[model samples]
Target: MSTVQAAIGLGSNLGDPISQLQAALQRLQAHDAISLTATSSFYRSAPQGDAEQPDYVNACALIETTLAPHALLAALQAIERDLGKIKRGHWQAREIDLDLLLYGDAVIQSDDLTVPHPWLHKRDFVLVPLAEIAPDWMVPGKGSVSEMLAQLPDHFIQERL
Candidate 1:
């Protein structure tokens, strides 16, 4: 299998989020089909919705994988499940969250997923770490990750850990 570069955004707001994220990273690094190449420092940010919920620990990872986009997504979803993540509703608090921010330059639109995550540009939690490892990565319909970070609205507070 050939290697493909992919990016993933991770966040958690419930129950020892920092530990959860750290463990998730370890599991990611352990995967035989995936090589975690780079990672940004953890960022603390407020919940985008459910403002009363706990703040989240967020970060992004750059990975090299032999799996296809959907296959990679499946792998991520499985990891989340292992960490007790549930998709109860949009923006709900969870033990761990993993999103496929990008898959090479592949443009994919499917009922279950979207490459270059739909809201990545608007979320500082996503863009900040993304910029760390992939400042030059281009969002298919947008510009560079660094440029997008510069233009997003000032709503979220991202502090590096």
Candidate 2:
């Protein structure tokens, strides 16, 4: 199968977040259908929804993969499950969170997933790390990653890894 470029967002707030992210990256690299390429510097950001929860460590990864979009999503989800992710609640703290941020330039909408990550433009945690690795890549309906990062308010502070 032909390989396609894709980006994945990784976040963790529970336990040792940095270690969780590092192990997750290793898992991605171990997958036969996925070739882990570039990874952005890890960023520590305040949790978005519930201020009471712990801050999250975030990063983005660029990969070359032979898996299709849904398949890729499934693989990411599996990685989360293996890493002890438990869905406590929406925007709640978790062991690991993996999001399929983009699949090449393909636009997709379905019951299970959305490409360009639906909220990539609004979340600095995702955008900052993404822009670090792929500043020029466009987000389909949105503009470039750097452009989207420019439009958002500077409320979210992210410390580089």
Candidate 3:
């Protein structure tokens, strides 16, 4: 089977946030169809969309996977479920949030999934960590990761861990 490089955005603001992220990464690394390549440094940043919640621990990961795009997404969701992700609502706090940020340079638009994550260009939380590991990776229609990061204004302060 062939493998494609992919990027995953990781965040948690509920439970032991940093530990939750570490557990999620361990699960991803254990998946037979996936092999982790690189992971960005974890960051503590204020929540987006909602301010009432606790700050989040955020990071980005690169992987090599033989699973197809949707399957890879399913795998990520499974890890979230395994780690007790409680999705109260969008942007609300959770045990963990695993986003499939990119799958190689493929551009996909579907009811269930979007590659180069629809919000990838707008969210500096993901962009900072994403750029750390994939600064040169192009986002299909948008520009490179570093270019996007350079264009986005810093909103919340990100403290490196």
- Candidate that would win on lDDT: 2
Q: Global CA lDDT of candidate 3, please?
A: 0.92
lDDT of 1 by residue, 19-55 (tens): 9999899989999899999999899998987888999
Global Cα RMSD, each model? 1.0, 0.9, 0.9
Expressed as tens digits, the lDDT of each residue in 1-161 for candidate 3 is 79999999999998899899999999999999999999999999998888999999999999999999999999999999899887799889999999999999899999999887999998889999999999999889999999999999766646998
Taken over the whole model, the C-alpha lDDT of each candidate is: 0.91, 0.94, 0.92
**Model 1 clash number:** 0
Where is model 2 poorest over a 10-residue stretch in terms of lDDT?
152-161
Once superposed on the true structure, which residue ranges of model 2 sit more than 4 Å away at CA?
Answer: none
TM-score of each candidate?
0.96, 0.97, 0.97
**Which parts of model 3 have CA positions greater than 4 angstroms off?**
none
Q: At residue 69, what lDDT does model 3 achieve?
A: 98
In TM-score terms, candidate 1 sits at: 0.96
